[model samples]
Structure formats: C-alpha cells, structure tokens
Target chain A: MKKLLAAVLIAIFSISALTSCGQGLSRFSVTYTDVFDTVTVITAYAKSEAVFNKAANAAHDELLRLHKLYDIYNEYDGITNLATLNRLCGESAQPVGKDIEILIKSGLEYAALTDGKLNIAAGNLTCLWHDCIANGTGLPTDEALIKAKEHISYKSVKLENGTLSFDDPKIKLDVGATAKGYAAERAAAVLEENGISDYLINAGGNVVSKGKKPDGEWKIGIQDPAKQTGEYRFIVAVKDKSVVTSGSYERFFEYGGKRYSHIIDLEKLYPSDRYVSVTVLCGSSADGDALSTALFCMSVSDGKALLKQKNAEALWIYENGEYEKTDGFKIYE
Target chain B: MNKKTIADIILVCSVVLIAAVMLIVTTVNKKNGDKFEISVGGRVYGTYSLSEDRTVDVDGLCVVRVKDGAVYMESSTCKGGDCVKHKPISKSGESIICLPNSVVIRVLGETDADAVI
Candidate 1:
C-alpha cells in the first residue's frame, strides 16, 4: 500500500510538472470582423501581464487604421481618392499617400511577376462580376466583358513621386488581394519597434509569426480547405515567418449549380477553376499574399517551377482534392 | 513520516508558490511602467510615457501630442474633437477610436508588441 501511494504521488507530480512547463505564456486576441468583407483578425502574444495589454491595445489601433486605408467601398479612402482623381480619361497625376503608393507599386510588381495573373487594375472585370452577383443575375455578357477589359490594364496605371494616375477613367484600383497581408506586415513592424518579441498575427487566414515560443518554435495549423472549422491538414512549426493562403473556399457564389470563385482571372475575365487553394510561406506578409494569389492562377507544374526559381515554398491543393507541397515546406505531423 | 512532517512540507510548498506568484507580478508591473500611445482613425488615444515626448499627424485628420506624462488630441478635423473627451490612457487595453477618420489610438508595453496574424 505504501509503495502504491508513492507511485501515485510520483505520477501526479510528473504530470503536473509536464503541464506546468509549457504554460507560462499569456494569450490575448482582438477580433475586428467588419473589414475585408467578412474577415477577422486574431493577434496573439506571449509576454508579461502589462506588456501583453500594451501590445494588444497597439495592435487593435493598427488594425483599424489599416481598414481605413484599404476599404474599397469607402469613397473617401486613398484608393478611391486615386479613382476620383483619375475619373476623367487620359493620364492625370494625383498625389497619393505613402501607404497607397507602396500597395500600388507592389500590385504592379506582382502583376508583372505573375505574367499579369494578379492585377489590381483588373477592377473593371471584378466590378462587373460583383454587380452580377449583387443583382442575382448571371455572368456579364462577353461584349460587356470585352469593353471592361479595355480599361483593365496594370501597365496603364502609372506611379511616380508618390503620384498615381490612370489612362482610363474606368480603371479602378483593388488591393483586396494584398491589403491584409500588407497590414499584417506593418503591424508586425509596429510591435518590433515597441520591443515585443514573440507574437502571431492572423488576419483572416493569412498568418505571420515572429520570434519563437519558450520551447523554441511556433506551432501553427494549416486549416483544411474542405472543412468549415477544425484543423484538417497539418501543423507547421516555424520561427519569424509569414504564411498566407488564398482559396475559393473562403468566399464565392454559386450560380446554375456551378460554384464561381471570388478570385478572377485577368486575361479570361472569369473566375479561375485551376486550383482549390495556394499557400505560400515567406518573410513578409505582402510577398506571401501576392505569391499565394499568383500561385492559385498558375498550373501546378508552372507554380512548382516558379516556387523553385524564387526559392520560396508553397502548398497547392488541386480541384481533385489532391495536394502537393514544395520541398521548402517543413510540415510536421 | 507523521502528520507534523506532512504539514511542514505543505507549508514550505505553499510559501514557495506564493513567493513565485509575487515575483511574476512584480516583473509584470516593472515592464509596464513605460507608457505607449496609438492613434486610430485620426484620433489620439494611449498611455502617456513620462520619458518620451512625441507627436503624430494623421494628415487632414488629426494630430496627437504626448508631453510630460500627459497625452492629448491637439488638433482634429472631426466635429467637436470628441477624441479629446476621453482621459489620457496609460495602462494596457485603453483605446480611443475616431470613427470619422477611421483611426484608433492605443497604449502598448515593451514586451507585448509584435504580432503578425
């Protein structure tokens, strides 16, 4: 009986020790659900009590600021400011905010990099589809699409000395594809400047983790695209990296028994049916965002080649539900 | 061992636990001494740091100034400048939101800063 009692006590102590060892970090999250249509932000950090509070407050402020900068529907926003200034046909220069300029430049660069697969100036095509969906009608006619396509050119949107102008009055700028990622990057910079070392920012599905957990690496779960909730695929342990995934599963409309993805193909002026989702890991949220969108528009073979060339990593899930990952992904079971 | 020995051990363990808790609390308070500020939607809100004097301009929106351990919204385009209505925030989780300009102000401590998600 004495020996059995001792064994039980020892077991209890060991279990307690194991649990206590991994339980020092405090977690706080602020959810801003209104922006990005239906997207939310969940920011977590590990720090002392006071530090945690301070960090959370700062992050909340940053998120609100980013929303104002990126809201496409907000007519007074800088993106709209550009649109209004360029409402008349022909090139007319308009001064833009630094943040807007960076986003525009990034959008054009990504467009060129992905062979025009990801174009912010493709707003004309996007708007037509948006209107169709809003009105509960079918896709726009081919003739209407062609007319819209004439104004959908990233090359025509010029940027110089913090001024942006468009050659076409119908040309609009949509940063929906990359704005969240850019915001995450900027928020991370704010935290770094304030001396917060270990944190994770999850803007919708895009995640950026900086520093490491007490045990070393940050463990993140990549949700299964098929499931509405719960972890489906695998967990990744990383340090100081950003992981962004773009998928049709998040937002879409079904018409005539067919599911149309939200991500539109600039050249075809229609929804893409290439891959189910694309996940990219990189050092910056902006890069991860751009690459994830671009990869979704490319074939598996081409995406693989591009990832290899860029020395970046990706996980591609095809329409058949089969998935392939680049060699750089260190997925943990 | 007798009950006396068990009681003594329990007492020691309890004392150690309390001490650890106190130590953590002290560490947290120490790190939180500095005040940080954040502005959202062109409204200034945050904890005023005694050591640093800083000013932020939202450009056609608002300006926030922190000086001598107090922070205030100095100028704003919004009606009534109601962001100035709130008291200066020095602790964590305090915030000021300017709805018109879509800006938010917050305070942060050193260790709890960087988050990417």
Candidate 2:
C-alpha cells in the first residue's frame, strides 16, 4: 500500500512537471466551423494567459467576420458578400468593399499567372456541379458542362474604375478557390497590426503562420491525403510563412461506380485526377492555396513551372501513389 | 501582541488557510471530469464535455467513453490494443495515446495554445 501511494505521488508530480514545460509559451486557440466548410483553428501567443485570451478572442472575431464576408452560400443583413456580388453579375454596377476588390482583381490576375490553369471564371460551371455534389445527384451531363464552360475565362470578367461586369451573361463568379487564402492573409495582417506577431491562422487548409513560439519555431504537420483522420505525411517548420494543401480526396462523391472529386480542371471540365493532393509553401496563403489547386490539375512539368513563377515550394502526391516535389521543397521532423 | 508580530501572525495564518482550502477544492473537483478534446492524426475531431458521461464511436474502429467526469479509450480495433490499456484522463493537458490507431485524447481548458504538430 505504501509503495502504491508513492507511485501515485510520483505520477502526479511528473504530470505537473510536464505541463510546466509547455506553459512557457502561453498559447491560446479557438476552432470554429467554416471559412470554407471545414474546421478553422486560430492560435495566438502572448506573455500571459490573460493576454493570450484577449488576443485569441479578437482573432476569432476577425476571422468570423471574414468568413461571413467571403461566404458564397449564405447572406447576412447589411453585408454584401460574394453571393450577392455574383447575383448582380452583368447587372447594374455593384459596389463592394476594398477586400472584395482585392480578391476579384487578384483572382483575375492569377488566371493570367497560371496561363489560365487557375480559372475563377469557371464560376457558372462550378455552380452546376456544386448543386449535383451537394444533392448527391452525381456528375453533370457533358452537354451542360460544355455550355457552362463557355462563360468561364479570365478575360470574360471586366473591371473598370473599381466596378465589375462580365462579358458573358451566363458568367457567375465563384472565388471559392482563392477566397479563404485571401481572407487568411488579411486576417494575419490584422493580428500583426494589433501587435501580436506570434500567431497561426488556418482557414480550412489555407494556413498563414506568423512569428514563432517562445521556445522555438512553430512546427506544422502536413496531412496525408490517403490516410484517414490524425494521419500526417510529415511535419514542416515554418515561421512567418503560409503552408497550404489542397487534396482532391478531401471531398468526393461516388457515382456510376467511380469517384468524382470536387477539384475540377479547367481544360478537362471534370474532376482532375493528376494528383491526390498538393502542398505548397509560400509567402501568401492565398497564392499558395490557389496555386496548390492549380498545380494539382497540371502535368508534373507544368506544375513545376508555375511553382517557380510563384516562387513557392510544393509537393505533389500523384494518383498512382507517386510523389513529385519542387527542388526547394523542405520537410522537417 | 506587538504590531509587527500581529501582522506576521495574520500573514502566516492566511497563507496556511489558502493552501489548505486549495488542496481540498482540487481533490473534490477531481471527482467531476472536465472538457477533453479528441484528435485523429493531426486534426481535431471534436471537444466533448466529460460531465455528460457517454460513449462515442470513432468512425467504427474505436469507442471512447466519458463517464464520471473522466474520459478514456474504452476499446479499439487496432491490433495492438495499447490505447485501451491506457488510464482515464481528467485534467487539463493530460492525454492518452493509441499509437496503433493514431487517436489521441486530451483534457483541455480554454485551448489557448496551438495544437500538436
């Protein structure tokens, strides 16, 4: 009985000691639903737990605000979100916030950047597939796909004096690809401006990391697309950089005895099977997030070329279980 | 007593009383389990309240239970079954790991820090 008592005491002391070691950093985090239909976690660092909580709440509020603004599905009163903007397509000039303008302008530029590989103009086509995916109605017909593709082209969107219009009447804008990344970048900046440099903002798969922990650099794990739950392919050490991953396997539906991924290809006008997943490390999460999808849909040679243009490092897991990476791609334990 | 002696006596009494009270409160609080978080691989699955006391099935491979304010890996289909061998967790930051299954259960409060790498 005495020995058992002593063991219990030892265990209690060890647990306390273990906790003290991690307590040095004073980390605060909040996880919420949606910025993009997945879980979003925001972690902030401060000298004390009290300070960390304040900053964390502020960060969460900021992200929630951004989530609502960029949302294409739902509408909130007094808020002009992407859904509303898209509804006004080719109609009277719709006024938008500065952030929306930034998203739209860059989205058009990104189309040019990837030589049209990353097409936001695929908006109307996406809506058609989106309805099918949501309702489990299976793939859209080839005729519908071909028609929807007509309204999709970066050049189809026209912006004049901060006003936006689409040349094609059927053109509908879906910023789903780049919106989260853009919001992540802007949210990180807001946290920085508020003087909290040590933070990590993960909006769905788009991550914008700023600063480091009190002990050392922040370590982030890359999720293995093939594995289910809690399985990570590897870890990456990052500070003041965003690491974003886009995996076609993340969301998929089976129809006609075959699976169709949500990540559609511009040229194929169907779910791309070029890569199981793509991870890109870059200065901006928006660029990295968009580029990861763009790269995933391209040939290895083309993906590598675009990664160079973005000055980003990437790792591509091919459909056949092959891995392709840029020369500068780095991973840590 | 003189003024200095009186002050010292009050200080000593207060410290002892506070320490004793804290020890009792903590011991009693341990009977009720706290909120704990579950994760698979590198992502958070959910945070559950231990006070509710219920069994949760983790996608069919494993079953987790929160009972009597404590959480534990009741069973798992993993070959090793090592996670099931682990003890129940009830305090902030305490964790149980099932390496074979890649499931981790941790008791957390406020969640002010970043999660596992």
Candidate 3:
C-alpha cells in the first residue's frame, strides 16, 4: 500500500510539471545609455535570469561595436571608423568594412529615391546646423549653408570593391538619420542568435520587436510629437516588425520663437516643416528610419505613393494637429 | 471505497491544492509591486519601497520622491527640468527619464507593454 501511494504522488507531480512546462520563462530587461547618444532598452523573456543576462550583454556589445563604427565625431584606436573614412576617402579610395560599405550603399539608394532629401552625403551642411544647435548659437547663416549644400550631391559618394571614395574631397557622411534604427535591428538579431527569440529592442524612438510573448503580441506605444514623452498617440500590436518615428519636436533649437529641427531639407536648406512628425512600420528598421525622415519632408500625396512602393505603412501628423495614416496601419491598432 | 483508494485520492487532492496555491502566489507577485527602481548611467542606482514615503537625492544630480504609492522626480540640476515636470509613475513599467543626467525612475512590476518607443 505504501509503495502504491508513492507512485500515485509521483504521477501527480509529473502531471503538474508537464502542465507548467513553460512557466519558467519570465520577462527580463536591461538598459544601456552609452550607445548612439540615446537610451537602449532590451526587454526579453527567457527561462532564467542568467540566460537573459548573457543574451542582453551580447546585444549591448553589438550595439557598441556598431555605434563606434558609425560615430562621426569620435575616433577610437585600432578601428578605421566613419570619421577616418570621411577624412581620407576624399583623398583616395579608402579600405572600408563590410558594415560601412552596406550602409553607404543603402544611404545612396535612399538619397536617390528621396531626391537627395535623405542624403547621407549632406554631412557638410548638417555639421553647420549641428554646431549651431550644440552651441545654442542659433541658426546657421544661409551663406554657409548654401556653400555646404554644394558638396552634398549623392554623385560624389562612391563605394567599390570594399572601398569608399568621394568625388568631392569636402563631402562628408552623416548616418544620424539611419544609424540608431539599423543598430537596433542588428541588436535584435544578436539577441536571437544567442537563443533569445522573444525580445524587443527600443533604441530611442526606433523599436524592433522579435517574437511575441506567451500571452500575445507586443504592444508598442508611439509618442505624440505635440505632447510630452510617455504620452502616446497610438498603441500598435506587433511581432517581428520595426516601428520608427521621426519628429521635429525631440531635437530642435528655438530661434526667434520658431523651431528648427535636426532633419534638414536640401531644397530649402532648412529644417523640413511639411509635417510635424512621421512614423513608419516596416520589416527593416533601417528602411523605416530613412522613410520616416524622407516622408517628413514630402507632401501627404507623395509620401503615400512612396509608402506603397515600399509596402510600408505610415502615419503623418501635420503641424496643425491633423493626422493621416495608411490603409493597412489600422490593422495593427 | 477501499482504504488504499481513499488514501490515494486525498494525496492527489492535497498535491493539486498546493500547486494551485503556488501558482497564485507567483502570478500575484509578478503583477503587483510596492517598490520602484532607479537607474543612472545604465546601472541600477537603488530600489525603494513605495510603501515608505521618502526622498532620494541621486548623486546630487537630481532628486526623486516616493509618496502615496507613486514615484516622481522632484528636482534636477539638468538644463531642462523635464524630469521634474513629468507625471508621477505608479504603475508597472512606467518610467520618467532625465536624459541629461542619465537618471531613470521606473515602477517595478509586470508591464502592460513590453516597451514603449
């Protein structure tokens, strides 16, 4: 009788274990602030804290590597980063890394698609505005901006045989518009490669979602450009996708009671003001990043056509508080 | 019923009751929080209980206050007091970040969303 009771108890315990097999997977998160001049938060679900830590650390390291490669002002030892390429590529065809080669190729493609509105080669013009914003010295003079703009034509940037060269020595490259999103997408892959399938990488405003949780899809809140941070305009349910938002409100300087955003328009040689903000949902965060910035500089009709070409959906919020979203965007909501 | 059969039934019932209690405890624990966490420079500064109303000065760079089951930034030395102006966060995963000072105050519990972009 005693042996039979013991067997029954074992059977009950085994059944309970099988029923709660996946209960060990818990949500864990880590934050890093030293990359890309923004906050990077990785929230993931794993069986143990140790496993989550291992995966999150690997992702953070990947982000750091990409951050150093894309950095324009800072130079690190033993790495021929973008700054080095910018300085010497104008003189000769400089040997480049595969990451940079891919970035510049995609950047040039975006520049052509957007008619130079999203030009990575516009570093010369952007730097002038950057200096002004950094120093709080107000806006850059139109004279200096025009001179810098002349060096931005995409034809001047060349990449061949794993080498990058500039037709114009003065041409500089700024990946500000695309680097954070690209890095977030890469970091998400790093998490997956480390056996973390359920995760989300929020690199500032660029969010990349991997697999959904046991409960349901991840809910991502898009910030309202006219309101304060943490204030959401919409909450979208998604899995295995990227959502990126570009707004004139976050990084801007107030000059003469007017705001000049960081996203410059080559045609006007000033901040693009057609829309207050543009948010894009796509498979690649890099493409979403470029599209959001480009769409911010375009009209609603033109932006819709471009979104259709890429099969991406967008929500455009005009300066007058009116908003428009693509036909398919409502499905996520 | 036989004595052996009655004994087996009681054993299984007790085991099921214990498992249900354990599951309930864990689910409640994950969903509710009486504490909040503070991080600076991507490192956790400290965790404080929301049950106790107190003030925390973060490396002399900013001040955080816990009151009535909510947490908020009371003051900051950063150029913009955006953190101070932010609403008090009481729910899980709600956070207020002061970018310049690299200070973040977040409620400690399971969040509705995995993240906010």
Q: What docking grade does candidate 1 earn?
A: incorrect
Lowest lDDT sum, 10 consecutive residues, model 2 chain A, at A12-21
- Candidate 1, residues B41-112, lDDT tens digits: the string is 223434356458788776657887777655556777876455666566554434454545555655554233
- Tell me, by lDDT, which candidate is best: 3
Worst 10 residues of 3 chain A by lDDT: A14-23
Please give the interface root mean square deviation for model 2, in Å: 13.0
Candidate 3, B1-117: lDDT as tens digits = 456676677677667766775786477547446789999987899999988999999999999998898889999998867689898878777788888888888888765556665
Task: Give the TM-score ranking, best first.
Answer: 3, 2, 1
Model 3 residue A190 lDDT?
89
Better of 1 and 3 by TM-score: 3
TM-scores for all predictions: 0.67, 0.72, 0.86
lDDT of 3 at B86: 90
lDDT of 1 at B116: 21
The regions of model 3 sitting more than 4 angstroms off are A1-22, A331-333, B1-34, B77-81, B85-87
Clashes of 3: 0
TM-score of chain B of 2: 0.64
